[model samples]
Target: MTELRISQKEFDLFRDFIYKEVGISLSDKKIGLVQSRLSKRLKALGLSSYDDYYYYIQDHKEEEIFHLISAISTNVTSFFREEPQWAYLRENINTIFASTRKIRIWSAACSSGEEPYSIAIFLKENLDHYKEYDIKILATDISKKVLEKAISGRYVAKDIAGLPKHILQRYFDIDKRDPQAPYAIKEDLKAQITFRMFNLVYDDFSIFKNRFDFIFCRNVMIYFDGSSQMKLVSNFHKILSENGLLFIGHSESLTRNNKEFKTVRPSIYERI
Candidate 1:
């Protein structure tokens, strides 16, 4: 096996392709990162170059594009991440449920199901007759690979380590059958969520006819350029129920000039 290099031509091609397809902006600095990250896939496919892998993904469309996303995007997430948002939710939860027992939430970038599962666990702890409440969570991600793992409701022990023992005991089942994947989210938690493959950048939003009370699109917009971010925020405003809340990454902010939503907390915006 000879040493293969990703030429500047190859870097420019993939950079544009990734941005156009997924709304993620890659800088010149990420050329090394892209080459290093995607090289493994090229090797696995027995391809000689990055150009070949790019075309291979283009040809496969549904399956390999997902693989591309899996390779390119960072799916760094943990249970109960961004503590302040959860605290704010705790303070306002009853108000969130005041008008009706029915609740619909979309974990817009639910990587590996941590955010959605955390939402379920939060509701279960706070609400009485929680199962009887008409609650449904639509968990979507661009990566089919992660969605499969999410739908399987399985996790390794390290992934669940941040979770409290009581919550873990109540919400997850120990997978005695597999030592590799020791923690599986129990049926009670699994039943509340529907996992789907969705591309936030290109997918049709009209496919969702129902309004959600809250949409957790956290940590994802940081990857998008400003124009894409504004467009996504505007679409979220159109689909939320009145006074619906949008939670973003702690480091991300809705532009100060934007009229669609107002800040409720740091990283929390309410549809106006």
Candidate 2:
């Protein structure tokens, strides 16, 4: 088997394809990264060249697009990723929910279930009479692979090493059968969340009927260009309930020209 090398032209083809399909802007410096990641994919599909894989995806796009996105995108996430966001939520939970007992949250780009599960645990711990309210958490990602792991709600010991002991014991059922995946999220926590495959750039937003109270789209917009980011922000603004909060990645911010939201805190914005 010959070593597969992607030519500069082939790399540019992928760069344009990815940008048009998913709004992710891949720079010229990312040629090596793309080649390294997609090489295994090409091998798995028995394709010999980058051009072959590119054309292959064009014909089998519905399924292969997911694979392409998964190959290139990073899904690095953790429970309670941004501490200040949690603190802010804790401090303002009452005011945020003052008008209604029905709460809806969208964990946009929620990877491996940590973010949504953390929300459930946070509500259970902080909200007085947690069961009395109508709560639903919608967790979505572009990759089906990650969504499957998230739906299973299982985690290895090391993945959850930093969590508090009581929180772990109360929320996770110990799976003694599989030491590799010892911690499984109990039904109580899993019940509140629905994991789905979603592409923020290409998916139809009209499918959403209800407005969410909070939207967590952290760490994802950085991959997108300025136009894509603004489009996503607009979509978020439309779907969020009045005065609803949007939490973006620590490194991201809504541009100054944007007026649909006002900054409540660093990386936190409220729909006006």
> How many backbone clashes does every candidate have?
0, 0
lDDT for each residue of candidate 1 in 110-138, tens digit (9 for 90 to 100)? 99999999999899998766656899999
Candidate 2 backbone collisions, by pair: none
| lDDT (tens digit, per residue) of candidate 2 on 1-272 | 54578899999999999998877999999998999999999999999899999999999998998899889999888888899999998998977776689999999999888989999899888886676799999999988888988999999977797999899889999876897799999997899999998888879899999999999999999999888888899999999999999999899999997899999999999999
**Top of the candidates by TM-score:** 1
Tell me how many residue pairs clash in candidate 2.
0
lDDT of 1 at 1: 52
For each candidate in the order shown, give its overall lDDT on alpha carbons.
0.89, 0.91
